[model samples]
Target chain A: MAIESIDQTSSHLKLSNPDSTTLVIHLTDDWRTTSHLAAFENVCQGLETMPSLNKVLFDASGLTGWDSKLLTFVLKVRGWCDDRKVDLALEGLPGGVQRLLHLALAVPERQGARKDAERQPFFPRVGEKALQVYASAGEMLAFLGSACVAFGQLLKGKASFRRSDLMLFVQESGVQAFGIVSLVSILVGLIFAFIGAIQLKTFGAQIYVADLVGIAMVRVMGAVMAGIIMAGRTGANYAAQLGTMQVNEEIDALQTLGISPMEFLVLPRMMALILMMPLLCVYADIMGILGGLIVGVTMLDLNPVVYLNETKASFNMTNLWIGLIYSAMFGVIIALSGCLRGIQCGRSASAVGDATTSAVVTGIVSIIIATAILTVIFSILNV
Target chain B: MNEAEPQIVVKDLDMGYGSFILIRNLNFIVNKGDIFIIMGGSGCGKSTLLKLLVGLKEPLSGQVFYDGTSFWEAGPEEQKRIMRRFGILYQSGALWSSMTLAENVAIPLEQYTSMTRAEIQDLVSLKLALVGLAGFEDFYPSEISGGMRKRAGLARAMALDPDILFFDEPSAGLDPVSARLLDDLILELRDSLGTTFVVVTHELGSIFAIGNNSVYLDVQTRTMTASGDPNRLLAESKDPTVRAFLTRGAEGK
Candidate 1:
């Protein structure tokens, strides 16, 4: 009879000899990951000395934990002793261990064997592998191309928005956004005019204060700042709206019905944003200039005629066009990022949130990057 | 004597993702105007097989022919042309949530046809009527119940009066009443329109009610073990997995 104490801390082994046979074998369930293969291999080698030992009982009840690689070693040892016609009886397999053994039914024994098998790879041959790589690359390229084409289709359908959908987006995205943009633009202009007046008075050149605020607000600052704010506000909203639809299977529903999700979903939103951005930029321009005019007329004690004339003269068609174009670019970028992220979203609530966050981040980053690049390019090209 | 060509022919189909082989050598045919159900447990490639049949996901190895034309092997435009003949009711019905019932149904009409708004509206109403959701045209998907949403989706799918209709778990995620109603609708559509139907589901009630023919996918072997009438297969099949699944309801009782 083989009796053993079930120690809670130290390791314990239980060897049950089912058959009547005299066998000498070292049995230890103190199976650490480090000593796993060595201990199992030592048991196999020790069996070589006992010729009469046709049966060996190895118990694993006391081993609280073991990794896959260690269990794999035990299976290999079992296989080795099995081939020698030695009945290696494994006793006290934990319930968890039994489940794991059933789970990973197939695994390689030797590293060399795995290496040899991996060297001459199966499943997908070289040609098929190359084809798969090419196919995936082609798929990615096709997706990008489709995205561009989708954007183009949206642009072409700029005039094709359903009166209702366009109006809804306009009311929600543009009209609702106006109050925020106007308030911010006015505050920005006030801050700039105040700063310019204070700095210019020290140089006794306070007259130029009106000109500085006028040129900056009308030319670039108002439109660019407004665009950035919209990118965060309305842009993120577009992404969230469409992204939610994508995750919720609405977009897929459209596709299944022989309707293009992009054409139906993105085109309408893009059209609305495109039409709204330029109008919003113009509104911001007016508000920003008006804010600065208040400071110039009251605080700076400047004549309305002089200030108005300077504001008119300091800004021109070129500056106006630059602001318009960049703001439009920013608007397009926002819509593009939002819709793209939305379509690319995975099927989970978290994925929709991720898309919304990425849409805002990408929209803002792209706007800044494009603005900087366009600034340098426009300056160099004298646009 | 119906002598029309088989609506769908899947020969030696192998569908899967990456290194994980989902199913292999799946061969079956759906006769014209037949209601065919594909039944299997969860994660048994039932959806993937449905995708392949509808030409949504290409098979890793094999061909799926729709009305004798290899839809996937054909060019994109040709594929779209072939796709026009088949209507699909995706699982969850996948109706356009933003659009109202009428607009959602009119989407296909708006896309591939030059049908006037009046004509499209008439067609939409007709489809809605067929699915028992008549006069609910202005209702947004969110405004309706799940049963109505599924009916709305069915209305949308039937917009083109397609020759073949594919239902991905049509009765899934529905109450017994709604599921039975959906099954009845499937039979009604087959009776009235004579359209071929392919449904992917494990609902035994729907299977018994609607399936004129079917295929059972075994998870262990990762292949179709039986393809025929459910009643015969359940009573006669020797495969334990097939028996386990088929008699699952009996076991519960």
Candidate 2:
């Protein structure tokens, strides 16, 4: 055995015995994160020339010390060997380190640790998405059907729900929602008057800004504005509350205790929203008319009494009824989507967040769609 | 060169919330390679003191030194650098809920090191394996059991190869078998790596098994009332409170 046969280096690590079938990397560094890192640069360089080598091992019982740095480097080497189908082992290492290595390697990498999820072609992906939508729609219908059944039980005075819970939800979806509703309504009214005044002033019809604002507030903007606000505020809140309960397994616990979650939870929230929505629409309309009055009095140089008279003239019974009816429809859609998302929430914190976001998106999209359809029908009927 | 100096030193430390001092006049030294424990009853501000030591909270008065450099007196960049050396395991594991375990470990390495993705991935798997979570890189924190989350938290703590690890109730929610395994892992890491540990726990098994030095924080007095080796303190402590606490209220028996 020639003494010079085993190659060594000035640094604490080296690649040795390149000519032999086995490859040996030696470690002599007092490995640490602070002072020195196990760079393994030399050994990595040597592996390039050792083409026929099939075995690898570590001799790390140098002079001083070691830590996870050394272990990390060794694990990297182990990974390299595994890829190349080489036998690797640890020798002449401390007992503690050897034991740690044993424990680390004790459990084989778990099955499905690296799932190479197959990528489908575009058409297949589109088909899958359509199928998913169909399944979701079916689930939604089933959920609404069950909710109606619970509502029937409630009407018969046999549902297991607390009136106080319904009242609390009503307060949350209505009274607590007043600030945002007022804010959005006022802004929308201001925007309407400003846009209308810009065009009306060209035709000396600037005073008609009040009529435009009042008519829009009572006809379409009131319900749509309130619907969007509630979607962001109360709808998101409902989904988050349900999602958290789902995450905590409270819904599961309720079911385990022989309680119907739909009857006890969903019914109350739905009733609260349905009961408060039309009232909120009326309040929103008043706020919006007040906003238009501010714009008319400030920007249009119109008298307050004249603006009020114009608003009164623009108000029609059919427009008011349609606005209230649309708000009621919005309430149902928002409540249904929020409660459905909550009930179907996955058991994770991120899932709760996603449910809340999905609730808002679903609520807003449905409101917009219903508005378009309602407006088209009303125009055809000349109402 | 660093062997003669203490790894950590706490001097005249005062901890509390806004003006209410929780623990005052705290002083201690953790020699290199020591498993120094900070023990107290619940609500005694054990976690608060830990925050102060780890530079998370400002002390009302006092100083903490790492390798004789006062942590509070250091510049912002120096303080940040000091903080990077710490491996803190909070009571709840505190793993990022959104990321998978592998991604959780990879974040620190990615931020601090200039390693390639392949190298970072290999290190991530190795760290997970060290915590007995080898095959669980793709699993999110919520999908795993509580014990597994704790283990994964430990894996993340060791991701950057910290010099000193601070644990808040490492064995709090673990079962007996898992707790013992954690204790064993802690001991083995200490022995093999010479990494210092400053753990906050009241679990007697862990205290006796791994702690070579410790300080007792009194709940009633809101002060650290005792300091020394735990075994020697148990046998020779004259204070009834210290004796009761050390013997776990079985002192007379």
Candidate 3:
């Protein structure tokens, strides 16, 4: 009887050659998952030393306690034995371990069901990402086309959506957003006046700080800041709301009920933001100019009346109209980006989160790009 | 067999949200290894009862006992310890959308056990294999079909090998064959591992196929109308409501 033993701190295993065709595995001690256990490789080494083993029997009578760790080791051995066409006898093991092994191995894994999680080469991954971006651009164009069609239907008085929903969205995106708009606009105006006052003070042109704050706030800063706020706040909210609806299959239900989601869902949101943007920009401009007055009176020691008169002189219809135009365009960009990303959201919780993030990013990036293009056009026109 | 030991006991349990009581004075006993079914018509608080039993929602009054310890009255630490021994399968197979099937099954084991990464992977594979999903480990929940997702959810539920499993509408959205296959799996798991099951379903085929014990909730009365073996209830129940529910599939078949 030639026997080989492999002992670990928490478990023990012994391999014995009872006959040339049969092998016996003796297991002892606690084989709990938290305990250090004997490795299955030792059994493989022992089997390699033996000649023409046809049967393997487990003797776990010395086991004090066991859990899934022991089961895992035995299963590995059983799999190895199965590949080698060796019979595995479990009658010598404990009753619980035997039953558990039988249960776990009862259902064989389906072939071709597992997917390999291999990483692609760097170039292929880059190519895949580029293709995805191109495809998404096409999807965005399609979504914009549908939005135009919905707007056309609205002009023709044939658009089908709840008027109440539009009213609710108007309240949500317009009046409810005033507190944040006021806070951001005032802070931006204060910073602009502070910077302009320092420069103008060196030239004894402190009065020009009023003109600087007024013209900047009216021309671009007011609209840009409001657009950014809406992008992060209302735009993200739009994406999350619609994305959740997509996840819950509410959009599908709407389609099944023969209602156009573009008309019923997207249109109301776009209209609300479009109608609110110009008005919000005007309100933000007033708040910004008021902030400039505060800085002029407190920091620059300018009379409040003088600051107001200088600000009034800086005002003109062209700059006001240009800023309004920017606000309107930004409103459209924010709404379209938010709704497009939301509509394209995949059906998962993480997909909704991605859609929300993408909406804010797309909204902000396009807003800046549109501002740059519009500013260049206005400067060339000398308006 | 010997006298079956009680695994879960509900006494004078009242479940509801706010002031509206949905189920009142509910009492039942789930013995060890019993495939217990909670059945009722639509809108009869079957799922609510499940929520109460699983510690997701508090009972309005009275007690829920697991192995003779009161669940609601227990401290938070004790409640968490007791809850750790439960496995729940939601109606929609609510798998984590961000993780693959392997990761989903591996989470509970990682959180609760000190097993090495390799051992956890082995246990994850075994659990997935038990639910007939051995090869689909790398796939995400959204990548699979509805039936496959349910099976994957079952694999995750069984990852920690809980003593009690709570299933909410296991066959709600599955086709007939897939539903029957799941029923068979439940039966096999119960027979082999002796895990207690509390299944909330109205599907008659599943109710009769796997449930050896059950409690029927009544919507109008806001309480349980019957409690016993599902087969025995079907054969001997005299309550017309219970009779109607049990024989619902008879007319369709």
Q: What do the candidate models score in CA lDDT, each in turn? A: 0.76, 0.83, 0.87
* DockQ scores of all models, one per candidate: 0.42, 0.01, 0.02
**B1-253: candidate 1 lDDT, tens digit per residue:** 2775687888998889876678998999889988888998787899888877766677888998877888777997778788778888877777767788998888788777898999988888999998889889999988988777887888888889888888888876688987888888888878988988988888887887788889999776789988888888877887777777888745321
Q: Give the 10-residue window scoring lowest on summed lDDT in candidate 3 chain B.
A: B244-253
CA-based DockQ, model 1: 0.42
Clashing pairs in 1: none
lDDT of 3 by residue, A1-383 (tens): 65544232223777776778888888888888887766777678777766688999988878899899988998998889999999999999889988999899885774544787889999999999999999988988999999999999999997877676799889988999999999999999999999998899999999999999999999999999999999999999889988887775456434422347899789999999999999999999999998898899999999999999999998999999999999999999999999998988998999999999999999999999999999999999989
Question: What is candidate 1's local distance difference test score?
Answer: 0.76
Candidate 2 lDDT, tens digit per residue, B8-32?
9999999887787889999999998
Greater-lDDT candidate between 1 and 2: 2
Comparing 1 with 2 on TM-score, the higher-scoring candidate is 1
RMSD of every prediction: 7.2, 23.2, 21.1
Candidate 2 lDDT, tens digit per residue, A251-342?
Answer: 64334223467886788888898889999999999999998889899998899999999899888999999999999999988998999999
| Top DockQ prediction, candidate number | 1
Error of 3 at A139 (Å): 1.0
The full ranking of all candidates by DockQ, starting with the best, is: 1, 3, 2
Worst 10 residues of 2 chain A by lDDT: A1-10
